[model samples]
Target: MPGTPGKGEEMASDLSQSLPKRTFKYQSSLPPLPVPSLENSLSKYLEAVRPFASEDEFKATVQIVRKFQDGVGKVLHYKLLQRAKTKKNWLEEWWFDTAYLEVRIPSQLNVNFGGPGPYLEHCWPPAEGTCLERASLLIWHTLQYWNLLLTERLAPQKAGKTPLDMDQFRMLFCTCKVPGVMKDTIHNYFKTEREGPCPSHLAVMCHGRIFTFDALCDGEILTPPELLRQLRFVKDRCEGEPEGDGVAALTSEERTRWAKAREHLINIDPHNKTILETIQSSLFIISLDETKPYSTPENYTNMTLEALTGNPTLRWGDKSYNLLVFSDGTFGSNCDHAPYDAMVLVSMCWYVDQQLRLTDGKWKSTLMQTVIDCGNVHFVR
Candidate 1:
């Protein structure tokens, strides 16, 4: 019985045996997604002529030509005329005499200079700095350059010409206010004071009120009258310290004193007077259509002028726009062609910053977003 095992024991021993196991492997095969080309995304029409390096040269040549045409069209057609028509009230230290000349605003001003698209303009040199600041600087520089050309041509130095004084300068800005509008807070100040309100507004108005600085200048001498140079000189003297008869312009300190002595215009804020208002009023909106070639920037300038000074019937649609402004917070029969240039607008913005500093009695800061809403063209000094 010990030597012989039971049938159940035998079967149990056989069942305890191990069996072979089969294995299956997984093969990884798929690759990663490709990144899209940035150039291709930015310009859908940009074609790749070759995988070779020479392909770049051909593309550059074509683009440069296109850029040249765009720049020429913009500057000749719109930019130059806009510069001629849209004057800025220059600050005291920066003011230039334009009257000693005869500068004419041609019915149609044209130029052949070429470079780049308006948007790409600031990028050409790449030395102009970042996009935001460069954009502002570009606009500022372009206008300045054009103004200098016009001034040199129309108001050149002549023999036996007397420079202008303050009273004459201030008179240039006394254009009728736009009808039906409330009196500007700054204007109220000028009404009470003998000297005037703000220099910046006065400056801008002086610049835009005149017909043409170019019409008056020729070669080394200006036209016989010399009213143009005299007027602009008066503007500068008013902004700075003018020394002469009572005919001379008021200095910054003198103006400040007058502003302080004056009640209606003087406020807790120093920049709140007409001087600051002059700068604020010169902001303009220049319209541009990028659709057609040879459609010069001047075309747009003409369009803007028409909107401002042309017939009511013509002042409608896309053409009906405003490029020049001399807002005094008032509206009367004479609103359309009030004075004030773009530089004056820049000065006004700076003046606001100065006022905030003086009023708050601290380092003043501006919330440009707030400015966009509360202190744009409508926010008079």
Candidate 2:
């Protein structure tokens, strides 16, 4: 399983009834990443090195390049071809470890990428005092997106008819990066409807406390009002209680240090291990921060700053995605770069922003009524 790309969650073909298996079927049929020829590789390497070297240094580098290309480089290239004979993507494992997991630094602002929620422009932002409400509404939309993946309704992404790798989309939910003494590992708990039962719970972090509840009730996705109730309960529960131990901040520490801390935490208390799994297995984390980091169309500096680097203790930085809900009803996200690239988040943001514009930050689906006691609020925007 080490070199395998997709989490061995592929659907079986012996089923009696046909189902939507396009997501994986196409991926399986598509070509594996091709290995470039040695000449191209060394030529590009020399081109890259040329810009950083002076005339004499460049000449020396060229001589070294030629000697290596004709000598050791050729041998290495032969070995690479032998390795490729057994594996389709020979570069995946090494590239993954070298580029991400083997790095020891804290992931926050260094390796992770985040920014202000661009959905705030053009009357698209939520009003004041509706942070929880707006968050619930946003969660509902996000769940819908998850359902798209589950049902295989989401079309495969492409670059001018050439399909792009859709593996990262699997990491969008129910995924967390687990730290180790030497390297980190990604744990993805998501399962498509065809793959069988998966975690439907949602985790909320507030006041340095973590809380989780099922995002689905009676086998149906929770309505906006229902989600609002859960969010409100988390808010009320954290308000009067003493602050929690803030274990999440440990995820913001160096990888090796965090790994040791996690080990000690589990060793001291069996319950601590369960708590960690509950979070890692959930859909994702929703962070309720007290600061507004107020933003406007002209200036998103404060919000962007808060989202990328604010409140080290408030978020589980290793989670695949952390939806940051500010006190003033705006939004942003911080995510682990282990399982996916930033473009996936950008595409999701674009989809949700367009969907929000269509519905005005609310849903037009069923279970729309004044249910919660919060002044008989109507869910219909």
Candidate 3:
């Protein structure tokens, strides 16, 4: 398969489009997480294990815990204190590695978190014949949110007067994880206006195929009409060709296996390496799903399940976020667990949902509050 596009090839490429790269960034403020005292931790552990322990087991555990608390635990606790003195957040790195990057399992089934957009069904229900239109609209709104952060126009989130950490927001876009044999590493391409350029491109997948274009043109975000044209081009291209090689499925493989496969793929063709980097550095993905996952205002299980477990070929499991746009006019997201805080994703979803509610679920022009009516549906160009 060297120098030839055939079996085991990286199917994500071949449209052969290119664009100028752009940059992005954000701000954050949060205190270090407090470490619990050893006595408090030990008592909680004992409480949790009581159900599994009989009277004798419980008594023996108490004796062992008392001895360890005075002996090994004291020394370990001192080490933890030393670690805390050296690191602002002693547990952060350990949690990241143990909970996600170091796990060798398939990320799709184990690490990624997928769910329906917050209250999305209310504004954009599962209506037929509205996939592409609504998708373009949604993408435009998402870019607007990204723009807020990029321009530093959005205020730092706060709880009362204290600023909550907004670090995860920056990682929500233009971020990805590269697989390693023992540990995966996050490649965040976002940079502050002062830090210089970050990627402004967007990658979209249709029928297991990927096509990318810069989300911004001439230092400005693309309008919804422009995005629709680009999406339509990808869809049309897919219709004319056979099913793609579905190489993205490899991302769902065991981390070590995926790392090895990726290495072989790159060695087979240098272009394969470029395509992989393009995907990793681009803004999060948009998956154009053909399946109609029925969902409504109250329940999003169908949509959520499909987003989490649908076509592995359509999802780049290591990306920080993969927006799933179903043919039934529903939307959900599959996000990596690295910058895996829920509130970061939730705040953006919540913002877009509110925007939709304000406009009564109609697509509106960026310059005005109203939309141009066309064929019983409102549109913005």
Candidate 4:
């Protein structure tokens, strides 16, 4: 009885037996990542240093490594083993915090990925009077793809017929990196199928002004026509009102500097913290850019660089994704790389591209007439 399987384990075994084996089926059965022997590690290190070190230096380094392996290293190795015994993946948390959260560089140029939208040859080409129209369609398709991820309907991604890890895809929506002094943290609002509620609000930026409105109404994502109406309201207000102070510029500063500035701003006024929280919690940022398209794939590189670093005022550098809609209906994305990899964005963009091609970039049937409230986020210095 002491070694017998429990009810949960028996059920899990039965389910595994009944279901057809597929990609990721054996994920839980994989062996834990092995830790290398200290002797082996030191031997490899000595081999690597031989070419770079003088003979005398190599001898001294070898002696140092020998002492380390015989002393502190053994204690540390035992601690690591104890940690491995308690943790499923010992390196995951350390890797994320060290590689992303603890880095002091500005995330825009250092940790963000930017690329142009794939709409040139497809149904939507560079043209006037198509910016909002194309943007609505793109948003609709993007939401549909997001729904797929939410429902776990997306097929497992693969490379050369081998199934790849799908964990990063879950971070594509409602994820942002919150800045801190020593280490930042990722705030993710994503939920698995049948898990819980996910954030459905979208942030829109125009002329340095930020707005937030629900992208879903009555348990349904807004139709493209409804999205168009919301975009028109933000665009028209931006055209009429003077540009507000670009608080988003502070995010592009060096990590420590931004952290200090953020603290000072929050101290000056508590409302600033609330605004920061709002932006961080939103699903994603949609930038209604006033610039025209570069009109060529080769020029996309420049466009992407601009989208990454162009206007600190109009872009949230820490958001997982910033959808930039140019005046000529061309689009691009500036994405922070902390929560996920570039492949997630690529997959979503590809889905939107294929949907656009299938429908010729036109919304079918009667447009929705719902009027949604969109408000500008005001910040006080």
Highest-scoring model, TM-score: 2
**Which of the two, 2 or 4, has more lDDT?**
2
As for lDDT, the candidate ahead, 1 or 2, is 2
lDDT of each: 0.24, 0.78, 0.75, 0.76
For all predicted structures, in order, the TM-scores are 0.20, 0.89, 0.86, 0.80
Backbone clashes (count) for model 3: 3
Best by lDDT: 2
- The clash count of every prediction, one per candidate, is 46, 0, 3, 0
lDDT of 1 by residue, 271-343 (tens): 6455333332332212111111221333434323332343221111111012221111101011211233333
Mark the 10 consecutive residues where model 1 has the least summed lDDT. Answer: 106-115
* Candidate 4 residue-wise lDDT, 125-231, digit = tens: 68888899889878877877676666555666667765667778878888888888988889888775567787777888888788887776665667677788878
lDDT of 2 at 23: 54
Query: What residue runs in model 2 are displaced by over 4 Å at the alpha carbon?
Result: 1-21, 366-381
- The superposed Cα distance between candidate 1 and the true structure at residue 247, in angstroms, equals 39
lDDT of 2 at 28: 73
Q: Name the weakest run of 10 consecutive residues (lDDT summed) in model 2.
A: 1-10
What would the TM-score be for candidate 3 when compared with the true structure?
Answer: 0.86
The residue pairs in collision within model 2 are: none
How much is the lDDT of residue 321 in candidate 2?
Answer: 92
